[model samples]
Target: MEFKDYYEVLGVSRTATADEIKKAYRRLAHKYHPDVSKERDAEERFKAVSEAYEVLHDAEKRRAYDQFGHDYRAGDEFRPPPGWQWQPHTGAHARSHRGPNPAEGFSQTDFSEFFSSLFGEGGFAGFGERAQQHARGRHSHARHGEDVTRPLEITLEEAFAGGNRALSVDNGSERRTLNVRIPAGIAPGQKIRLAGQGTPGSNGATAGDLYLEVAYRPHPLYQVDGRDLTLELPLAPWEAALGAKVEVPTLGGRVTLAVPAGAQSGQKLRLRGRGLPGKPAGDQFVRLKIVNPPADTPAARELFQKMADTLPFDPRAGLG
Candidate 1:
């Protein structure tokens, strides 16, 4: 059979790190997954990517593959060295003496002839037995489905208020709609899991889970840091010089904030428990930005000239 260059298939270098390989695999898997991809050759590409990851992600498999893979190019006729055979040890590759079972969901039939030649027919036969040991009295042919993770983008408001969101997912030949709950105070990079929502299992096996990683869409008025929020509040010169109560917008709603007398630009005022909700809720910080009224009209210019003459304050005195 022809040799497969797994690194080339995944578009990564031979010296790529395990994390790099995993990232590459996830990106390709998401792009080419048969349930969601629009490309005509998506199924084929997805299978190839999965097979590549299966070998590359395993340290033992990778070491063995690299030992003899240097000489052959992809698609070239290839064969294992004479007297070469696979022996299982500890870890995921451990095998039972039950021999090759074609009924297993993960087998040589699921991958290419090239893969089988490299890793043997029964290499993955023990995967289901080991991974699903908790499963009781399962059919001999049953196999759990693959888990999937995808990014879910939500608005800041939705994250703060906690609500139900409708998400549509495509299964083999149909569309499935799922209503997901958004918890209040859910932070970015947190994951929400849905059980039995991933790829369907075979022969009555339980399906895998689906994970939605949360991320926030850009908000126009606020910047988030963990659960805390920062809002730039603009104020007139008089409002800063003389204390004033101003209406400020927060995640919860508008609230009156008292600006201390002699408030300077960039001064921060904290509003306790005004950010995201939790046991100890985050606080919102309003940063003061003093704005000078424009002297576009004659009256405004006269007022500015009057202040310059009456106020004996020289701003440049400190600079010298």
Candidate 2:
């Protein structure tokens, strides 16, 4: 997967502060929302803008992204389908769609969920509150409870096919385990919400949501890029030059990687649909990192001498 420049997505610069980015996201998304707009590609554009906002609005996600570039989402990539689902009752979306100030620190997805909660899918919940308020404005009790965050580490295999994750958290010094169904193709720093799992509520309402921030323990030899998995495959000089079928590890399992004869070091090979799975699975990138064996033995020395005498290739011929 290619690097998604969220700053570019929201039409802002890297130097733009959180507030500026938020404003841009709202302006662009509101213009493109399908409900009010008749423009072509409005829905697609709206999803893009919302996706961008989901990253830029959060301080931690933004910082990780700025430091690592594409590597920010190395463990996961948070791409929701055109119609996204969220568990708002979990207080995971605390800052979105509350009072007048709900706009202060919300990703568009959070805001959209708030609307979705009040008005069900296809507007089934509808917009009765807004219409009824015209005759008699009621006090807005839809206060956003505090957002709860917890860190979780998953294996490379689990990261690939996301699903319901059973987890526990300490709230008021008490731990409670809950099951959270993670979406497939989730990337690191992307939050998973468990609705109605947050702080104690007033008005005898149910508890709020618990937000689980996804991360991972580094897997040996495997590095993630968006939904794609990358591996720096070490090969012997002979295998790289003479072509071989070498077994390599993928998140799914092991598969034989084809090495073309005379393939250069740092050559990249793509394994189609072998990465993180979703509606459309991502590809795996195998970068060939050639390793020359040490000439510790006479046999190794003789092999090197023979190769040096026969091979006519100049490895660094490009540098003048």
Query: For this target, which candidate reaches the highest lDDT against the unseen true structure?
Result: 1
Candidate 1, 237-295: lDDT as tens digits: 99999999999999899999999999999999999999887667899999999999999
lDDT per residue for candidate 2 within 37-77, as digits (tens), equals 79998876776677567657765345334433422232244
Lowest lDDT block of 10, candidate 1: 96-105
- Predicted structure with the largest TM-score when compared to the true one: 1
RMSD of 2: 12.1
Q: For model 1, which pairs clash?
A: none
Estimated TM-score for each candidate = 0.57, 0.54
> Each candidate: what lDDT?
0.77, 0.63
Output the worst ten-in-a-row residue range by lDDT, candidate 2: 118-127
Off by over 4 Å in 2: 1-145
